[model samples]
Every structure is written in C-alpha cells, then in structure tokens.
Target: MPSETKNDRIFPVSPEKNDTQNIELDLLLQAVFLKYGYDFRNYSKAHLKRRINQRLNISNLETISELQNKILWDKEFFRLFLKDLSINVTEMFRDPDFYAAFREKVVSVLKTYAHIKVWHAGCATGEEVYSLAIILKEENLLARTQIYATDINKSVLETAKQGIYSKKEMELYERNYKEAGGKGELSNYYTSKYGSVLFDKSLSKNIVFADHNLVTDGVFAEVHLIFCRNVLIYFDKLLQNKVLGLFSDSLAKRGFLCLGTKESLKFTDYENKFQAVDKKMRIYKKLYIPK
Candidate 1:
C-alpha cells in the first residue's frame, strides 16, 4: 500500500479481510460489465486492483465497495473510473525496431497485393496508425492500403481521428521515425501551430477510426496485418488467448500480426496458427493451417 514501491501485493490485510476484498473487486467488475457492457472481468487482477486502488486513494474511499457504489449512481464518476481502467499508453513508432522490421519484412509481401487492409487493434490515440501511414506513404503503398484503427475507448478514437498531438512530443517521435527507417522528413506530414501539431488530413483519407472492444466485441474485419502492440500485457492469459483467437479468425491467410515486445503466442491455443516472422520483434504470420 506504500507509494513508489513495486509491490505485487494488491493490498495487505488479514486472510479473512483479503478474501472479502477479492469478492468486492469481483462484484464491482461484474456490475460494470452488466451495466456498461464493457467487460473487464478477465483483465489481470493485479492491474485492475492497482488502478482501482489509485482511484480509491484519489476519491478518499476506504474500500472497493465504496467505489462500486459511486460507480453505480454517479455517471460522471463512472466515466472517470472507466477511463482509468482502460489502458491508453502509446507512442508513434513505439518500438522503432518493430517498425524497422515491418519495413524490411512485411512491406515486400504487401507489395505483392494490389490492395491491403490493415487492422490496428487497440490503437490508442492513433500515434502508431499515423506512423504506419507515413511508412506506407514513403513506400508508395498508402494509396492502396486501408487502415482500420480501433480502440475500446471512444474518446481516444476521436483523438486518433483528429490526428493532433502536442508539439513538445514531436522531438521524440521524430527520433523514433528515423530509427524506424523513415524515408523522408517527418515534419512534412504535419503543420505546427499554437503549441500543437495537426497532421495532414490526407494521412487518414484511407484510414477508418472506430470504437471496437476486443473483450466483448466480435471479429470486426478481415485484414492483412494486425498491429496490437503493448496491449496484451495488461490482459490475463485467458483474455490474451481469447483475443488471439479473434485475431486468428479475422486475419487473411499468411497475413501478419504484430504484438508488443512483451506479448507472444508461444503457450496460447493459437500458437500453431501463427508462424514467428520476428521472434524478437514479436511479429507473426498467420499460417494457412496449423503447423
């Protein structure tokens, strides 16, 4: 319960009290699922508890039950609580090496296709989507590619649609772009004004930003590539396997699937369904048949 500690302990208490707290957390997640239809029941318990505890500290609540009461009645507070639960951390060309590998390994396959459809799952704030757009543009593939950028949070989807980011963050993103094998000036894609940068609307001409929840929603689109980086780390094994199955069902044969460096399909039920394209980069190709 101490601050600045990397403690796996959710909260310390007597065994009896700990059991009650666990039940409280489960009931709260169930309520959220039933009322809002945004399922978080299968999410990693430690992660959820950490986030909920942070809210409890801010709201001066002593228990998870207290937080649940406010969530059921106070719509505004529920919105803030929901936002806390949805992990939206992301950056453009997040892992430069992954993008670099994509440039080297995936682009060639894409070139073979007259048209391409890419699904960017859990595309928080659209940074990576724009990064891919710039890559495709330089490769002369943007005109033929349709990018489907989706996230469970509608607010983040709007942010992605606008393609605006803080001017201050451009320095880091520019560095990432270069490391990711950017072929042209990064500034050419966006104009800066009044402390913000608004990316060219044309970058999104072939892109679609929509609200899609991997937890409860069904397969959305058949795509050639699926980029879901830095997302599965927050999910439990069960949820991870479930989402992987969804990706398998949606991807075209021999299509590519990219995940965060920390995520892999090694022990999942769908492992045989994908062939590792770059194990270090966590990129995989959907096999035509399990091998």
Candidate 2:
C-alpha cells in the first residue's frame, strides 16, 4: 500500500462512493429522528431531494454534509427546514370543484351526525379550516363541531391561529368560496384593516390549531372526517401507507377521508378499506366492517 488521501477517491477512500452517501443519509435521518422526532426517513426520495436542495440553497450550504452539519449545530435551521418541508403551497378552497362536490355529497350525510369532529391535517395557514367552518356554519353544524387543524410547521401554525391574510389573497379566496357553493357573502367572514383581511374571531371558537407531524406523531384525536389533502404527496409510498394507517385508526366508524385531487388510496394497501364517496372529489368513506 502507498500513501493515500481522502481526495484520492480510490487509494484511501473507495472509488465507488454511492454506498457512503447512502450511509450518510441514513445516519442523518437517524440523527434528526432522535433529536427532533420529526421523521422524514420514509418520505419520497424525489420530494425529499427537492426539499433538501431547497434548504441547502437557502442556507448557502455547499453539500448535503454541510447542510447536515448546520442542522446538527443550529436547531433553528432544523425548524426552518421543517417549514420548507411541510407548508401547504396554496390558498383557500384550493380546488373549488372538490369543495362543491363535498358540499353536495358529504355535507348532506354530515348533517345526519348529531355532532362532528373534523381534522384538517397539514392545515397550513388555516384557510381550509375557515372554508370548512363556513360550510359547517351554513349547514347548521358549526355550533356543535370540534375542528382540529394540524400542521408540522410551527410558524405556519401560528399564522393559522391568527387567521389574517392579505386583502389580495382574501379577494381570491372569496372568489373561490363563491365558486365552491358558498351560501352567504364571503365578506361576512372577515373585516378589512391595513390592506389585509382579518377573519372574525368567532369563526375559530370551535377550532384548535396545533403542531402535529404525520410522520412521527400518533393520532391526537378521533375524528368524524379527516381532510389531509396535498400532504401525502410529500411522503413516499411507505410513509404514505403509515400516515394512512394513522388516519384509518383516527377516523371514527363510518367516517370520511378526503385527500388531494392528485392523490388516491387506490394503490395503497388501504384501498379496499375505503369506498369512493365522491370519485371526482377524491373523497372516500371508511368501511364500517373490513372485508
């Protein structure tokens, strides 16, 4: 053997270094899990890579190792990365057609339930929470309902609790509301101040905004309906199945599960466990008895 160096890539370090990078990624996931308990280990490799690249760019890191080093040293960086990883990318009534179908099909059945518990999982900035609130209010069920709005991003959670959005965004949201079959004036929900829309404080009376990570946390409450839209796409197949498992367990008997327009349980192992209540709306009702 002759003198070798780390940069040699063959003499001291193996020329085939893919295994080393994989081991590094494994260790990084283990470290993050053990430290913050926000599990991203099973998330989709493509999405994770995208998010990781975004984080690295924002942090000005030269390599994944550099990002990992910063994450280990700066807890704040970890939180920021989590925000980049989990925050929903859009506005209220994200898909108006979905809401319209939901109102027509699901709300009718929802009215039959004496009381309701709705969970808006990965509810970034609370727009969907308010949307659901409006629907429930119109249906005369808001007074007897409990809404749990959860997300992994603490910063977004705070914003969701505040329920303040820019006037411009509110304008678009109002349009979305109207198109989604809103029963009353969208202006009734919020007041304008400083060029922004501040939603009525009363709307959130029955709502709870809390930090909940689908990746690692267990179900906090059993719910009559779970609206976990656009969140599972961030997760890999294994993680998607795990999160769906938690949802299946969390939903009450004969409950509803709503996913994003692009997502479905068809390929998931849970397909047979849920029946399509609104095919186009991506809404499914859980089976009362598993076949």
Candidate 3:
C-alpha cells in the first residue's frame, strides 16, 4: 500500500485501505450519533476526511479506528473533535456584496412588517448576526426585529453570545462594514480594551443565542428571513435537501432566504419554491404555492 503525507502525517493510500477507512468512518459517525447525539453521518465525505485527518495529525493517531476509540471513551476528546468538525469560520459583514444586497432588496420588504423574526441558522461566533443587527439598527428596524442565532456547537455559541472578538480582525471587519453600506463608523459600535473589542451589548439586546441542530432539530419558529450562509456546502446533497425542506417549512409566506455564494437551490427539491431576489448574492424569497 502507498502512503500519502498530509499535514506532516503519513496516511496509507490504497483502494482496499480506502474502502476500510470508509467503513470505519461510517461506524465512527454512528458511534458519535449514538453516544453524543451529534449527527455528522450525512456530512460531506471530503470534508469529514479532511477534518478527521487533521485531528489524526493533531492527536498523533494513525488511523480512524484509534480516533474512534478515543472519541467513544473520552468525552473531552470528543468535544475537541466536535470543534474541529463545526464550521466556525466566519467574519463580520462577510461577503459585503451580500449584505449590500440585503440592505437594498430585503430591508425594504422587512420594513413593511410590523415585527420581523430572523433565523440566522449556523451563526457561528455571531459576527454576521451582529452585522445584520447593525444594518437593521441603521434602517431603524432593530427594535422591531427578533433575531434567533443558533448553532450546533455550544462552544462557538458562547463566543457569539459574548460579542467579543480579537482586535486584529477589526480592519477587515471595518472594510466589510463599509462595503456593506454601513451608515456610520464600525468602531463606533464597539469599544477596544486589552487587544479585544467587545461589541455593543445593545446590538445583542434583540438577539437570542440558542442551541439548534439543523440536521436533527425541527422548525422552532415561523421566520421572515433565514440567513444560513456557507453551511449547506459542508453537507451532502441529501442533507442539504433535508435542511432546505426544514427552511421551507419554517419560513413564512414570501419570506427571504440567504445562502452563501457557493450554495444555491438550483437543483434542490425546493428550487421552484423560492424565487431569487438577488441571484448574484444567492438571496431568494419563498414563493407561496397553493396546493
């Protein structure tokens, strides 16, 4: 069997070996589901393999089997692995054009509503959630809005609820805020101390941070908008469809759905159920279809 080097760790590569690894991976995910109730069984295989490989290198383990044993017996180790699997890569006002479009297209319709309920699914670390709040505040809609930001990872949700971020990211966040049509200086929204910036607590006053798994959880609220960016790409097609169904069921009539740039409903079961409000930014409005 041939071996390949990844992150300075050698992994055996062969058709038979790969087959064995696949089976082991399936069993590992099943164990995680049965024990911890975290379902990654329907996640993208490539993503799973990459993250598992990284964990293997970090833990100095050679195979998936060893990692599985550690996860099954050690609750702490599983928590660390859960962090690795959770998609926590996010930034304030990420994909500025998307926010800009949301401001131009979605905010107008949102203003017509008496009260707005926003479900920011997979809101890792809450940067984007605050970004949305800032936009709503500027539009004078924050007071009428209730934002529900949920994530599968409890650790990241804590960080999101804290509303504190490293000072190093301010430059980029400021740029994004400006590009997203921020009315005032991003600095005005936060105060800096000891190399960290704590965003204004007022920004989170209307926001609720909670634990909700899109995979295993059912619809909790009928929302006017759902912002689930860059998350479906991590899921396989079946899981994506399942999640889209959940979103469809959860959204109110003519509500909005925003996805990451790389994701879309083009080939999904709910493609026709949504009409693109800003196709370039992957923002869509739910279409009310009569049975």
Compose the digit string of candidate 3's lDDT tens values, residues 1-291.
554455555344677877888899999999999999999999999899888988888889988999999999999999999999999999999999999999999999999999999999999999999999999999999999999999999999999999999999999999999999999999999999999999999999999999999999999999999999999999999999999999999999999999998899986888888999999899999999988
Which parts of model 1 have CA positions greater than 4 angstroms off? 1-16
- Which consecutive 10 residues in model 1 have the weakest lDDT in total? 4-13
lDDT score, residue 18, model 1?
69
Per-model TM-score on C-alpha atoms: 0.94, 0.90, 0.96
lDDT tens string, model 1, 1-291? 557553323454467866888899999999998888889999998889789877877777878999999999898898899889887888888999999999999999999999999999999899999999999999999999999999998888999999999999999999999999998878999999999999999899999999899999998789999999888888888999999999999999899999998888986888888899999999999989755
User: How would the candidate models be sorted by lDDT, starting from the highest?
Assistant: 3, 1, 2
RMSD per candidate (Å) reads 2.8, 6.4, 2.3
Per-model CA lDDT versus the true structure: 0.90, 0.84, 0.95
Q: Which stretches of candidate 2 lie over 4 Å from their true place?
A: 1-24
What's the distance in Å from true for residue 288, model 2? 1.1
Clashing pairs in 1: none
Q: Model 3, residue 114: displacement in angstroms? A: 0.6
Candidate 3 backbone collisions, by pair:
none
Candidate 3 lands at a TM-score of 0.96
Candidate 3: where is the Cα deviation over 4 Å? Answer: 1-11
Best by lDDT: 3
lDDT of 2: 0.84
